[model samples]
Target: EGLRKAKSRLMEPLMQVDITTPEEYMGDILGDINGRRGMVGDLGERGNIKTISAQVPLANMFQYVSTLRSMSKGRANYSMKLANYDFVPPNVEEELKKGFVLETEED
Candidate 1:
């Protein structure tokens, strides 16, 4: 197909995320964010609470509310909005392409 002959890449949305949590949970929160492929940005504190800012892919944020609640013992809060789109990692792109091919072949 013409599409296959052309150069194309898969992209995914990235989000700007800010999280506020008790100081005690800072380490756990940071670890979790990193594990989710988030790039940590700013860190700040207010009283016993800490604030963390990061950019994370939207795909990694599904059901994040539940994860945050459990990790922070219901004490952390976060907000995220779409920041931009970036190319998917090569491995993920390959998997997506394989799935797409399977779906098209079944039709």
Candidate 2:
């Protein structure tokens, strides 16, 4: 009852993602990150490899190893850690709520 009266928002975990890939694969990697609702933070370099830093939602990172391998032909590598929690966008929240089911026990 209290929850109904108060304002609330769905929150999701965001991850700080750091990727290292060859120059040739930079565009593909960046596109993929954008598709996952990621925000690119920095662009840097280490020797011949290019480095990308971005923040992406944890939900979109499942099975990312295979995707990265295919995109970069096993050349790119990435690591991620919990960055923070943020409120879900209205559209995404509505979609999530559609699949949610509530169960109650009979008294």
Among all candidates shown, the one with the greatest TM-score: 1
**lDDT of candidate 1 over 1-107, digit per residue (tens):** 56678868878999999999999899998999998889999999988889999999999999999999999889999999999999998988889889999999999
TM-score of candidate 1 against the unseen true structure? 0.90
Q: Write the per-residue lDDT of candidate 2 for residues 1-107, one digit (tens) a residue.
A: 35436866789999999999999999999999999999999999999999999999999999999999999999999999999999998999877765552322222
The regions of model 1 sitting more than 4 angstroms off are none
Winner by lDDT? 1
**Predicted structure 2, TM vs. truth:** 0.89
Model 2 CA deviation exceeding 4 Å by range: 1-4, 101-107
